[model samples]
Target chain A: MTWEIFNAIGTIAFAISGAIVALEEEYDILGVYVLGMVTAFGGGAIRNLLIGVPVSALWDQGLLFLMAILVITVVFLFPLRALKQWKRWGTFTDAIGLSTFAILGALYAAEMNHPLSATIIAALLTGSGGGMLRDVLAGRKPVVLREDIYGLWAMLAGLLIGVGAVNQTWGLYVLFVAIVILRMMTVHYKWRLPHRTIKQQEDVSV
Target chain B: MTWEIFNAIGTIAFAISGAIVALEEEYDILGVYVLGMVTAFGGGAIRNLLIGVPVSALWDQGLLFLMAILVITVVFLFPLRALKQWKRWGTFTDAIGLSTFAILGALYAAEMNHPLSATIIAALLTGSGGGMLRDVLAGRKPVVLREDIYGLWAMLAGLLIGVGAVNQTWGLYVLFVAIVILRMMTVHYKWRLPHRTIKQQEDVSV
Candidate 1:
């Protein structure tokens, strides 16, 4: 996917997830829009902060605020049509968002000339940090800290981008394709690191 | 007051308020620190956002985070000493914070060349918005929106700063003195806006 296309997908996917979480929390109209915008844009802000970028929320405030309100209004009116019903859609969007954030973060880190490890770390953070914060805000355990197929997807994308930086020619599509496929397959089967007998019993308790 | 001194007062005042709110809510240690920092710095962040200033939170993250943790630690260690047992002090610090934030917000806006009304609005928001959010997070009625001397002091400071800007010789101290004195006296005297009287209340209810 082109950077712009994938970026759009990332924003919408994150917004949908945020809406779902807000709905589960029983937020009001304003609260739903706020969570949606916050979950979509919050990771970017944190990434910019880490890279010491200047403030950029200086968008035409009217336009963005209007857009956020509009999205909420439409969702309220037609909640079913506002989001897809297919299970695969969720998996697809999640994968797309993960890859998009990871690459964006890696590129930003490179622009900041961080070391490889730092770049990888930042990329992974940018990729999954929003979901982590969203879960925390929604009063659920952070998906990143759970014993499942997570963080590693972002890590893989970051590693790909970090190594590809040496060659400096892998198009954005290449990274997106690799990350989406790997992530979907892992999450599809609930693939995760092994747990010992004690850990298994603890999981049952939880 | 110098920026340093005003900032210090804001830091300690807001931190104390946050901790008290957190304790009242029975938050965990980590939750307490996080709430404390947000309560302290959230207003300034909103102020910077409205005026396109680089938020102090971006540059002062380390110091702010460290101060939050330290304040929480101190509060935990010496509850009596840390939280000065002055019911009047509660009224006092809260008022001072409101006034100072208003002044600070106005100054930043004037620097950004926003219109006078917008400047005043931003000032009012900066003074009370963070506290409002803090109260919401803690599940209490916002003091600013209730029957109190809270938002009035902010308005008073805004008026002083707005008039000073007309003269074009307003320094930090001039604004500081006007804000602090008005707020302090308002609290000491228990000044408040007129509220619903018995007849008026009955009429409204009917």
Candidate 2:
């Protein structure tokens, strides 16, 4: 309902998704915890620094955040086998985290009175950067770099928030609806970019 | 040598050593280059931030520094096997970088008119911090946390610099000489603290 609430939810979503992926990679506990914590907090820290907050936000409520990451890592360690095996859910929850975070990052940019282009770019970056980093460190090609709908969902959510801001009608609820609707549609239709189906015009040289 | 000269030498020394250690960990060329970059420049970056200097010391000359790292990494990668087997030389080089950095850090604190104890501590930290971070990221136990002479040599170097400062007999050259002398002696004798060492004690307690 509130921004703080959504941020917490997004953090948990990312942490869980990170833990699931780490398990699939057969990482040790330290790797799982590291990946999970980074996934949960890295984007926020990057955003905060760009917005002139140098220290990590985790220090504000350090123990709670650590517990969130730890719990998810522990879950993926043993009892969360079903979640780890559910490839589609892993892909889908990752999308949810990505799209929602895009909205949150754009909100921070608009709050800072950044111009539309920079605001949108920051939103897009924050939403996707953590997952990209996590995948790289985990030694896998990132899903967004594939033909997945992952990044497109987040960028669309960011675009929606930017449009709302342009019309001077932006509100928190607008962001919430945008993320959920985009994520749901993406999941429902298995939607991705029209990259594969784009018109193939011959070059002028031809 | 002026402090600036010693500092420049120390930075390059650390970078070269860092590149070698990174190769020992079997990193790819890009990773090895970045590791060397961190080893060389990380100390001064921290010191700059602490003393309120701008951060461009990292960002502005970043490409040149990166080139240094790349050159060193490429040069070291081939000869690394022979080099690693030179246990004595390896330790000596590591000690040299450590001691040089420590003395430089202490000199900086003295320049800032920091209190004696704080100055000593800062110097020791600067000397060892870069390598400690490098080792940890490379998945090695930090060398300073060993029961060996690693951190002690740096402190000894710092202490010598501090004494020179106290008696007004200090010059940058004097401090540099002290660091090199103490570091060489420590390496020659395997001059670790005995079984009652702090590292041993910490390990026991933990």
- Top model by TM-score, which number? 1
Candidate 1 on A1-206: residue-level lDDT in tens? 35556556676666656555555455544345445665665566566667666434323233333444455455545445334342456557667777788878787787677877867887788777777656655555667676466678777766766766432435667777788888888766868877556545645863
> In model 2, what is the error at residue B125, expressed in angstroms?
16
Deviation (Å) of B15 in candidate 1: 4.8
- How do the residues B154-192 of candidate 2 rate in per-residue lDDT, one tens digit apiece? 555556556664334355556566667777776676675
lDDT of 2 at A191: 78
Best by DockQ: 1
Per-residue lDDT for B1-206 in model 1, tens only? 35556766776677767777787688997777777777788888877765667675546657655775687677656666635574667666766677668877777766666655546656776887678667767766455644445665565566656656532435666766667777777667867654321111111100
Docking class of 2: incorrect
Residue A108, model 1: lDDT of: 76
Interface root-mean-square deviation of model 1 in angstroms is 14.9
Q: Which runs of model 2 end up more than 4 angstroms from their true locations?
A: A55-58, A165-171, A196-206, B1-18, B21-35, B42-54, B57-81, B84-206
Residue A61 miss distance in model 1 (angstroms): 9.4
Q: Worst lDDT window (10 residues) for model 2 chain A? A: A54-63
In model 1, the number of clashes is 0
lDDT of 2 by residue, A1-206 (tens): 46666677677777776665555555545445545766776677566656555422334544446556566745554544344344555555565567667777877776777777756776777787777656655555666677446666556655656666433334655656666666667667767666654566786435
